[model samples]
Target: MSTITPHKLGLHKILKHIPLNAIFDAPAKARLAKAVNIADLRLCAKARAHKMVFDYLDAGADDEISLRRGKDAYSQLEMHYHVLSGLKPPIDMRTKVFGCDVDIPFFGCPTAGNRMFHWEGETAAAKAAEHHGSLYGLSSLATTGIAEIGEIHKGPKVFQLYVWKDRELVKEVLAKAKEGGFNALALTVDFTWYGNRERDIRNDFSIPPKYSVAQVIEAIRKPAWTYDFLSHDPYTYACINTDVPADSLAAFVNSQIAPEFDWQDAEWLLGEWNGPAAVKGVVRPDDAVKAVETGFSTMWVSNHGARQLETSPATIDVLPSIREAVGPDVEIIMDGGVQRGTDIAKALALGADSVGVGKPYLYGLAAGGTEGVIKALDILKVELDRAMGLLGVGSVDDLKKRGPGLIKRRPASVRDYPDRYAYERGYGGGVI
Candidate 1:
């Protein structure tokens, strides 16, 4: 029989309180005040949001293997902290991305349909980003219009574009982005087709969400969310032109994708914008290289938050290779599974110019509106500052200069090697 340790007893006691204190009826501000970290914010959001809405924000493609892996990859890294290096107060976390200075190395990602989560929607997120002086990304499928977001967020903004079957519509949107004072363009390339999001399917989730009997019960359970949703303007794809009609909103959105889009087409779009642009979903080294050649000023290394592909490698795991492929000059923004300040530091140390976050801020938005979002950003900023101080670095550039020397992959656990013979033979029993 195995012996029980004091640490184990302590852990068990902590676990017991989790369920006992699972309160969801508190006011949004009160609940948000207790959230000291992104994970805490996530819990608050989960308690406040409807089941379908929470799942839509939280779940990923099919088995969610990529989502799990993306987070696992970050957790597997061990930082080589430097003690007694005499780092001064107020660590410099500021960095420039897309030719705009940001107070932190983190930025918001372009997530669609924010209104489903909170009535304030993208405007709340934009307000939080502006407050933090972090870049904000506006999705093509945003619940708020492009011009409105641009007018609201005075800080740097990137307009994420999805190529549509209608070229004229695409041009019109791009023109609108330019007029709205968006600093740059991010052409998202990985979403040629929607992934099989089983959670959404199971919940019967849709744009302008339709509630079934079970979902109605769920809405009643989350009375605060339901009340706010009902009292607000009816949810619609506020960014898309209303004239385009289809059998269902989902069908219309899905049918808008130009499946035959290619590098030539991407180049054409780049030419059309003729300004600072990033290719937002390049994961492969070869693809990263091609993005630069095709005139993209930055390569956004992402797997669409692990929402598009099931088994794709974590964005952090691919950052170094993409950086090497694109050389030192081309900017790289690492996205997906960034839950901590350490994750941001690790990405910068691995060669990312900046990192983009999607679910964290969205979780914050759901938990406490703009206040929650600001808290989420503040948590990351504080964490990153602490990490930089502990790492004996003073600025973002110093962390990047130290590079792989400051962090390394943790060795695989023995349990990961069920086939010991294969491991000894150097043939496939290790973690990928």
Candidate 2:
């Protein structure tokens, strides 16, 4: 059994009390409905967290134009539906991911310092995934160690690894994960340098965020997250310390370990883990091609939740070409900007074998705990089933066909539009 699962009487019990009437009445539930209604989980999160955290989750490099475009691109494309499609009274949301069969096409992406949001941290996320028959991914920076979550949960698990200056540290963490029966080792490649998050700057965010008197009062309003947080001592948070060498939290983040990385280092990591090593943070077609050539079992595409690298390309915009470049043999997994089941469907339609979701589940963790996390996943399952039935597709195969037609090269007429039309039709529509 994996160590992490939702605690019913602890934090999740309150979730059972959330009245359905409150789905629209309660502020949190209402926002959850908004997220589920639009099939975008990010909406649920943006509504609740401190503006600073929201910006941290939502921002991207330079102007964030690509980030906006990434979601908007999905909006511009239309979904095709077949009426009276054979709708299973209830749909099957489970599928095979990596080498394990999860109940859904989703996994909890490893998120660090979860204690900042709730006391359970990795345990809540991992347990929720286990309950749903999914995989729980643990961050190298997580508050709850892999052992904790792995001990409590029975399901597929993944460890997100960051290469450090100390090779022994990397081996040590890997050994722990292996001992815990972790199934996959995902190496995050894009965080070679963290992104310029302006909101985090305003919040003065850190691994262990400092609290002001005002912050304490603000926390009092959300008793659910606060109580659990207080349940763990040390007042502030940060439970994961994998015996890696680092001085302070700042040093741990900035100078303590490796922030320098490249493809060669990644290939070496693949050899080191000597297991199912997936290259996370891949967003370019060429990079995806080389990832396979480099001998990775999967191309885990992401934009670091748009958290790192202010200049990274849109993970979604680059997915199609990468899928084409690598062909069907390679596994194309995606993350970033996925809030709804429809988002999951869209990615699958565009060649993603599956997706990894962040933030929204954290919202669930903050609002209710394990039950909240499970609610978040269950929300996605319902949304996905409805989306598939509406699209008139019967199964995953039907959904895969929906992929090719979803995106296409701009037609010359539409591409040129008024400018090119002006050139070709100038004699007929305007002065030569």
Candidate 3:
């Protein structure tokens, strides 16, 4: 087993000089999470005006156990320490995903109807990604088209695909994404019928939106988000709206999206794309392997932030084995529950090539716009640096070799011990 050294000391003392205070507790603001998480971010969203709208973003299918589990999954993994490790030099979160290199191990998942958040909306999120040196996945369903974000950010832009009943729409999006200089495409496979999001059911949040009296009252609560939201250009991506010509986001999603999508669709789409496409919404090893055969350059394991389906109760709990199945050659990217830097280390050590973080940066976007996004990335990067140093490592590459064997799994993670700790399972057993 490797040992800890004194070189790992002073992570906190050093970060003290870096000014995390501005990120977490801006001199002018109160609790940022409360505002961003509740009001400006979600609580005040037009979704609140209509339950259907809320369900689209806030609720989940069935009992929402899976949605709840996604958050809990992160809580289940505990971090251990190597007290005396010599982690003197700073740790770098920098890594290469797909072809382009990223400043950190995390990236942004493409979101739709961003204009609903603010006029700057998708634009704000894209700039935030560039400023942080991370990849931005733009949704085909985005209120903003691929070209807008692609032209703006020089780093990396990944196009997110939603399989439509219209093969023409699918091909058009691919051609547009390619034309716009999108590097890789990620296809979301799990959502057949949009899940029954109870919140949206209650709020009736639509594309153009049908604001109710309560929604108007709800919008009035968050002054800042409301102002920016109303200031935008008619506030929607006509690029997507023109495709469905539906009056509501819900109607468009239901009418145009295909629920009978299968693995064959993956192969067909791959033939059309002619680029390094990845399959999003993967969890099991069989599916990962199947996706690999379907012509995906990589298999991304995610629970769609537990927003789309409720079938799998958790995502993080299953990554270690997915790594073993895909092996080292195929890239494995995961998201859903990466609140801390240590969580980033855990995913990499388990064999994920990289991960996509959703809510954390979304919260940042909601809180302070572009600056908030920067702050969120700063928090994760700082934590990653400190955790790496404490673990006595110098780089993300080195940490991949450092696993539970380097230090004991914290007691809280004991129930997950059998699977997460046994990393040599090869490709058959989940225990790997």
Q: For this target, which candidate reaches the highest TM-score against the unseen true structure?
A: 1
The lowest-lDDT stretch of 10 consecutive residues in candidate 2 is: 423-432
Q: How would you order the candidates by lDDT, starting with the best?
A: 1, 3, 2
Candidate 3 local lDDT, 97-136, one digit each (tens):
8877998878778777765544456777889888889888
Error of 1 at 108 (Å): 0.9
| Candidate that beats the other on lDDT, 1 or 3, i.e. the better one | 1
Per-residue alpha-carbon lDDT of candidate 2 for residues 292-313, written as tens digits (9 for 90 to 100)? 8888898998988766665466
Q: What alpha-carbon RMSD in Å does predicted model 1 have with respect to the real structure?
A: 11.5
Task: Estimate, for each residue in 124-178, the C-alpha lDDT of model 1 and write its tens digit.
Answer: 9999988988999998888788888877898889999886889898898889888
How many clashes in each candidate?
Answer: 0, 18, 30
Regions more than 4 Å wrong, model 1: 1-26, 242-249, 413-432
Q: Which candidate wins on lDDT? A: 1
Q: In model 1, state the lDDT of residue 422.
A: 24
